[model samples]
Target: MTNRPRIALVTGATQGLGLALVEGLASRLSPADTVYLTGRDAGRVARAVAGLPATSAQVRGELLDVADPDAATRLARLVEERHGGVDIVFGNAVMRIGPDDDPRALMDAYTQVNNFGTTRLMRAFTPLLRDGGRFLVVASSLGTLSHLAPVLHDRFDGLSSLDEVDKQVAAWRDAVLDGSAAASAWPGFINIPSKIAQVAAVRALASQRRDDDLRRGILLAAVCPGMINTPTSALWWDVSTAASPAEAAVPLLDLALDPVDPGHYGQLVRFGRALPWKP
Candidate 1:
């Protein structure tokens, strides 16, 4: 049997880092292998798939809005039916807004997409992972636990259940909506908390499913791709010195395609190095 994975999927692959991830996977996999380039926008997904080189792995576009509760599940079912299972799944979809936007709106959007979206995708796809498969949450350095207050440490560390994470995330959201988030030590910017929740979800689910993971050789982690010059990043800060999407995608591709290391599972990784969750 060939060593190359037969199926790979990347979400939010319409542009920027997501698009580059699709490119990297397509180039790396054999022509017989398939890479699904998914995004919420049908037009964008179709265009992104059309633009990829036909000489590489077969690239197919699918409309996937992670925020929609049923979207990930539907795709998972379809993938399992067609491919039997998937080799790699990159949860790269996220929602971020400019600092000038209303804080409440940002919190709501971020919670739904970045937080809930991640957990939903994990639940849907984790079971479909083939042996030696990798499921990655495309998080960032901001997702680190150090960004959270010291008081919140134990709530996230070595979580044994996703429900524990959800309760904490919901509490944070309540703090935000009640205008007490800042006073309560939740980050003023909604992105940080949402990312923290995303990472926590990954950690929790990885722990919760350790038995199945070990049995199937599945690997899970939240990865930081570093600062990339994408349209979204350009909105909040000057990305003049930031890496291009292609450059940022390299480390992530390495983690997804390289050999699985159990040590890296359930951790926050940057450039193949796992970062400490605690300060």
Candidate 2:
């Protein structure tokens, strides 16, 4: 590893879980470490960075929209130039749920941001993620196998490659557009399916990295922080029983900071505990 400080990046960090994760990470940063807080809006990124508590490690803000491949590439280049490489990447950026009346539009929006956007980031940043690094995808419990149709669940559970997962997501998108998603027993909501694809992609990446002849030693994981009461979530859920963003971020922080355990690779973590993988 280079003598430069270890680096961490969190996307969509203006508010809610992303912001909370940034705060949790700030407290744990070593003097040599630096954290980058990124979002689509420059103004929001600045405000979020300014509000963070003082830390030993430097905290900086950058503008990033995960949906843009050029933006992902630019961020990767910037990190490589400044820090040599990143030690941790928190993929927290997500799209808002659109109106259900337009199923096609809704599916397209979620797929772009939640699925394809994630693929872009992973592809761009994998080269820049130092050996023995961590890539944590912020997923949700709604993506669990229990929520999918049996056929879809089997396909996801048996995923062997990222390409296969990508194909599945594409198929789902096509199904939605053709109005055959319900016939396939797929849920109407876009969030759950999008997250399901995200988790599967994470699993595929972890498996690929581990089996590669040139191992990167990157630990990949998908985490569900539960129903946190964030501004985005507040619109749909009652905040009464929902955990605060800070509270929900605890488990994510633990996973990011902790040593890479091979057993946890490719796992879906809920509140810091790894759930059993279905064969």
Candidate 3:
């Protein structure tokens, strides 16, 4: 790592996986560093920061709603002004809805926060990342290309820019909204496509920024923490045997703080292994 003071940020950090990530960063980073934990609610953000264990690293909170198109850019500007640049950023803010929920009513909001909102965060903070920085998105295992239709493989695999990814995701969203999605052509869970879009954005950006990332020692990857027993997981699976957020956080922390790995850049990773885009 560079000698410059490290500054990190985690969005949706009021509780569960996001909060656990904030705690882990505090424990791992030196006292000289700072970690910003953000949530939509001011009270929750304040409480989350206040509840963290005493650690060498400084912890603070900020109010952020990833769904707000401008919130991320505003925060990015603030961080830039205060610290010059950011060292680590985790795109963890998300929305979860059950299969029974009304897709017509919730689909737009869900896609907005989980897909477009995340892409916005990446765009906003990536420019301010310092040398040797790491940009990681807490995506899901459902994001694997194997979950999508075979016909869609080339489109996702060939995505070379964020705009292309956005267009693809928008096409998917438009199809769902228009009731034109062929049955079984996509995963039933609405979350899958959103996750896929988020991971694809990582790949596209990684490709776009390859030279700069290599020159500056920056690493970018989307990680699947897997079946964590958070409220989000409870919506779709039995939590009896699921890993707690803290346990799931172990590998994620390693990915965030470990030495930069070129092989993992632009890949969707699970347990430190890169998943094949097309399975």
Per-candidate clashes come to 0, 0, 0
Q: Give the TM-score of candidate 3.
A: 0.96
Query: Model 3, which residues run further than 4 Å from truth?
Result: 182-184
Backbone clashes in model 3: 0
In candidate 1, residue 93 scores what lDDT?
92
TM-score of 1: 0.94
Clashing pairs in 1: none
Expressed as tens digits, the lDDT of each residue in 1-279 for candidate 1 is 137548999988999988899999989889789999999989988888888765478888898998898999999999999989898899989876886788776676677777778888888998888888889999878887789888877766777777788788888887888888767767787778777778888888887777788677778999999889877788888999999999999999998878777888888899989988778
TM-score of 2: 0.90
How well is each residue in 1-279 modelled by candidate 3, as lDDT tens digits?
687789999998999999999999999999999999998999889888888889879998998899898999999999999999999999999887886797757878887888888889999999998889999999988787888788777757768888888888888887777777646386656777888888889999998898899788898999999888876568778987989988989999999888877888988889999888777
TM-score of each: 0.94, 0.90, 0.96
- Poorly placed runs, candidate 1 (over 4 Å): 1-5
Best candidate, lDDT: 3
The 10 consecutive residues of candidate 3 with the worst lDDT sum are 180-189
Against the true structure, candidate 1 has what lDDT? 0.85
